[model samples]
Target: MPLLRSRLLPQLQALLDLLLPPACPLCGANLPQGPDQPPLCPACLAGIRPLESPCCPRCALPYPAEEGTDHLCEPCLRRPPPFAWVAALGLYMGTLQSAVQRLKFSGAIGLDRPLASLLADRFTDQVREFEPDLLLPVPLHRDRLRRRSYNQSLLIARVLGRRWGVPVACRSLVRTRDTPPQQALKADIRQRNLQGAFRLLGPLAGERVILVDDVMTTGATARECSRVLLTGGASAVAVTVLARTPRP
Candidate 1:
């Protein structure tokens, strides 16, 4: 009975797919019928601009020019970040930007799985090398979390945690206070805005942590979160985001 049920499941899913085809979340285009197919379609996938080479080794900041090798950016040289490095799926532009904004601001929670899958596919090798034991999402202040009803970063982190077989430290790091939004603020102001905003719930015994977020704009948030984690006794911290904002 179990073997028959297992064999019939695929055929049942195929039949369901034939009747009610899935649509691309980004573009609303009908997707091909297949269990193995990605949530996004080929066209939308191609539209996402990947963050390629010629980037900062530490922060993953893409240099303005397109023809150089990976090297340390000046900022990192002057003052190093708490995290060892950053991994991102693409530059925050085009389809990727749209997807992130929708997931973040517009409450498209369903986008989490597809976005996490993309990140895993691109950075699996680097993440494996890092050998992270725990995943932590940048936390939302209780007030903001109440208003938003969901933390997109936490959602993404949960998906990645399941995929990589890592434990998610969901409440270990938290926002102590709600600050003004960072979207409209300048880089220096963004840094100050997040000052003393995070608190680590308990001490970490030299665990390697991967900080997950939806986007990296000025990177002030990531830096602050990593600092707190490191201060709380985390041995190493690395950041991973869905997209990275290019330098202006």
Candidate 2:
């Protein structure tokens, strides 16, 4: 009975697909349903602009110039960040930007799977090299979490952790204060805004951690969180975000 059911399941799915094709989550384009059907349509996938070279290797900041080699940006040179580096799927614009905003602000949590899959696909090699001990999502203050009813970062982290076979620690690092939203603040003020906002739940034993977030703009939040994690005895930290706010 089990073997028969397994064989019939694919045929049943195929019949259903032929009757009603699935649509892309980002753009609503009709998708060809199959075992290998992508979560997003091809056009939407192409629209996601990758964070290319000629940018800061440390922060993944896209350079204004059209072309050059990856190098340290001025900020990294002047004041090094606590995290070793950042890995992102794409710049926060176009399709990627729309997707992030929808997932974050519109409560479209289903987007987490596709976004995390893309990030994992892009950085699987780098992650393997980093060999992080755990995946940690930047936490939201309880107040905000209560209002939103979800932490987008945590959702993404859960998906990535499962995909990468890494353990996820949801409460290892937490937002102790409900800091004002970073998007509304100036770049310089962003860091100040997040100062002492996060706290490590407990000491670590030199675990390498991959900090996960939905998007990164000034990186102030990531920097502050990394500082706490490092101080709490994490050996090293690397940031992974779905999108990076492109420099204007």
Candidate 3:
């Protein structure tokens, strides 16, 4: 009976799928009927544009035009961030933005899987090349964590760590103070707001760390966290995110 049930399960699932078609989370479009396909439909998935070359090597900020192989944005040239490098999957717009909003504010925890998979696929070469010793998610304030019940950055980091065979140190870095949302503040104000906002829980001496997060706007949050990590004895720090907000 067990063997018969196992053999028939796929057929039963197919019937159910036919009766109730799956919908794309981003656009509410009908997803192609396939057990192995991602929850996003092809149209919605295509809307998430991947980041291309000619970006700032230090911050991964997309440039207006192709600007040779290696270049630095004005901010990086004037004052370099604490992290060595930044990599992102795509510009923060279209379906990518929608997905991030849903995962972050709408309590869609399951979105992390597909988002992380896309992150890994988009930057597997870079991650392998950087070869970080540990994966660190930007820590959230306790109050916010309590309210959200999860850190989206940590969720993405956990998935990437599993895929890349890197160990995740979720507790090593922590947000010691609650600060105003960076998005709500100007670049300079954002920097000031995050001052002394993070603390290192343990030694990261001589370690190469990769900071993971959902999105990068002005990069103030990543900078602050990287500063803390560096001060705690990390040799180098790199950043990876699901999306990056293009500069105006």
Candidate 4:
């Protein structure tokens, strides 16, 4: 009876799959109806390249070999960001951009694992370099969280935090204001828009905090969060993000 049931299960599942087919994440091809693999087609997954070598020491952009050393981007060398370090899971590009947008805007919470897994692989050493006592995802304003129903950053943070043995603090920071989207603003305007927007939830004195976020465009958000954490008495702040858009 056990053997029969086991044999019959796949046929039953296949009938259901035929009724309701699922699509591949990258190319929208129909996913096979079984536990053989992930929803993304193997061919598509193989073509998806992660940024592996001679990349930017900070932000992990694909750069020339000679330029990536010394652990500083040209911007960091000239005017260092407030956060001591930054790390990204992969270089942002075609399929990655779409995946990130889906996670952010289309309620594709399922993509969190793949994204976080990539980040975990890339930041192995940098996460250690910062030596955070805890991971704190950037706080979403109450209004936005209500509309979105989830903070994507926190989702990724939970995955990576569990793997890295670092505790995630989902409530240690509060968003005191709901500012306009940062993408439309200039650099100074972006910084000003976020000013006084974050506050510590409680005493974080002497705790080195790692701020996790989905994307970094201009570093304003991370910088703002670091300012709040530093003022709140955390020893230091380092940012971990899945992608960083190259500044135009």
Q: When superposed on Cα atoms, how far off is each prediction in RMSD?
A: 1.1, 1.1, 2.6, 4.4
Question: Model 2, residue 69: what's the lDDT?
Answer: 93
Per-residue lDDT over 1-248 for candidate 2, one digit per residue giving the tens place of the 0 to 100 score: 99999999989888888887888888788976666888789999999999888789999999989878999988999999999999999999999999999999999999999889989988999999999999999999999999999999999999999889999999888888998898888898999999999999889999999999999998898899999999999999999999998886
Please give the range of 10 consecutive residues that has the lowest summed lDDT in model 2.
31-40
What is the C-alpha lDDT profile of model 1 across 160-234, one tens digit per residue? 998888899999999998999998897779989999999999999999999999999878999999999999999
lDDT of 3 by residue, 1-248 (tens): 99999999989988988998877766777888875867478887889888777788889898777556658999999999999888898999988998999899999988898788878877888888887999999989999999999999999999999989999999999898888888888877998999899999888779999999999998999899998888899999999999988877
Task: Give the lowest summed-lDDT range of ten residues in model 4.
Answer: 61-70
Instruction: State how far residue 5 of model 2 sits from its true place (Å).
Output: 2.9
lDDT for model 1 comes to 0.92
Model 2 TM-score on a 0 to 1 scale: 0.96
| TM-score, every prediction | 0.97, 0.96, 0.88, 0.78
Local error of candidate 4 at 121, Å? Answer: 2.3
Pick the TM-score winner.
1
- Please identify which of the two predictions, 2 or 3, would achieve the higher lDDT against the true structure: 2
Error of 4 at 70 (Å): 5.1
Write model 4 residue lDDT over 130-237, tens digit each, in one string.
778999999899999999999999999999898788999999998999899898898768888999999988987699888999888878899899988988888888
